[model samples]
Target: MVPWSLWEKLTTAPWLSINAAGQFVQWFNHLLMLIPFGAVIAVALGISLIRRRWWSAVAAVVIPMVAYSLNIWELFIEQLGWWLLIWLISFALCRTATHYLMLSTTCLKIANRCQFFWPLYVGLCSIVIFHPSWLVGVASALIALIPTFICQRLRLFAQLPSKPLEQAQMLGANKAQRMQWVAKRWLTPRLQNWRARTLQQSLLYCAFAGMIGLPGLGQHFYQGLSQGQHAMVGQTILTLLLLQLLLWSIDHAHKEVL
Candidate 1:
């Protein structure tokens, strides 16, 4: 058992957040890694599911999406064009994947698609791919999305009414049309259900980023631990746990409200 004195430091308050001005900035920085991945998924869904054409969806999704760069502090205009270009490329890739999923007749065909195979191949071949702290952090959050998306498929099967598809078919809607007009609306609500998990994933990645000093609570925790500042570590962890609880409550309330 640890002595009381050994545990004494844990009782002190951490002053890390006392400077209110930088707190929000720090919080946003922590979530930066998650923003692009979220954008990809959101764009893919909005285009392929709702609008039904990946290319047409590009102009709509991309134009409004440039707004994300506005969230970047102090150089919103100067760096906006570069960020827009990055978003454009990322969305194009994601939309291509959406097309693959939309067009594939069989699961086997999707399994054989190039996107999954090649990125994973490149990710594996480049030894340094997983080593960079920034890369790993982003990858962890994106990986967390895998199970969530799978669950969405299962939820869709259970929740979708076959009668609607039959009605759409009788109304002369093609397979793609029915999926776009009917399935898309049904699937959109499922987005809300993922909020809790997304927050959980974001926090997990933030902690991961902290391992390499990526300017988040994770980094703060790492510093506190290295410096033997148990009190600060305690403060940071408890705050994150509280944030997690807050997110869960918010998600639940959102569902209830909807």
Candidate 2:
């Protein structure tokens, strides 16, 4: 390991230069690290889309609350009820706020970045100060999904034709059955594409999470840059190239499905 003091005096840092195999490994590692994050985001989006509105809001709040509760447990040492109370208050505020903001793009942006507002919340808990954990990634990824739920709900509201419900009623299709069929037909493809993109967004959010003291390449990259380790930063950028390739492939896959 390079000492921080030694790093400061070094004439040149060598890790900046990576070979083809090394680059491949870096990209693969970063992607692998984020796959769980992508999966979590996908599930959260699916639930929000299907459950709709207030339920979706509750799902988004619960994810981070559970995460924060566990982190708090390590600090409070048996105050589960206290932490739960705090989270419930938060959920009430979020629900009321969601009711007002509803469908705006600004609301969407705020939801996806909800944790960004409480970035310091993690720091308040003593357990997270010295340790980095995957729990943070899961919590943050889920927390970031608030905007996705809001956006998907509003998108469905706009896209679903009023004609289908009326026509289905005339055809003797009950409300639940018609909604099931109509929503499936119209929203499946869009949701599939959205899921793929959401995965990418979750990964990017993880990078930002990394900067804010979570464990992963984002933090690693931030630390390297802070220490003036250009080589390490270079590796992180290459990993980003890999992410772009994956995203390109996902986009093409969506088109093919369409």
Count clashing residue pairs per candidate.
1, 1
lDDT of 2 at 147: 48
In order, what lDDT does every prediction score? 0.43, 0.46
- Give the worst 10-residue stretch by lDDT in candidate 2: 72-81
Best by lDDT: 2
Clashing pairs in 2: 16-231
Q: What TM-score goes with each of the models?
A: 0.30, 0.28
- In candidate 1, how many clashes are counted? 1
The residue pairs found clashing in candidate 1 are 210-219
- Model 2 residue runs over 4 Å out of place are 1-151, 158-161, 164-216, 247-258
| Cα TM-score of candidate 2 | 0.28
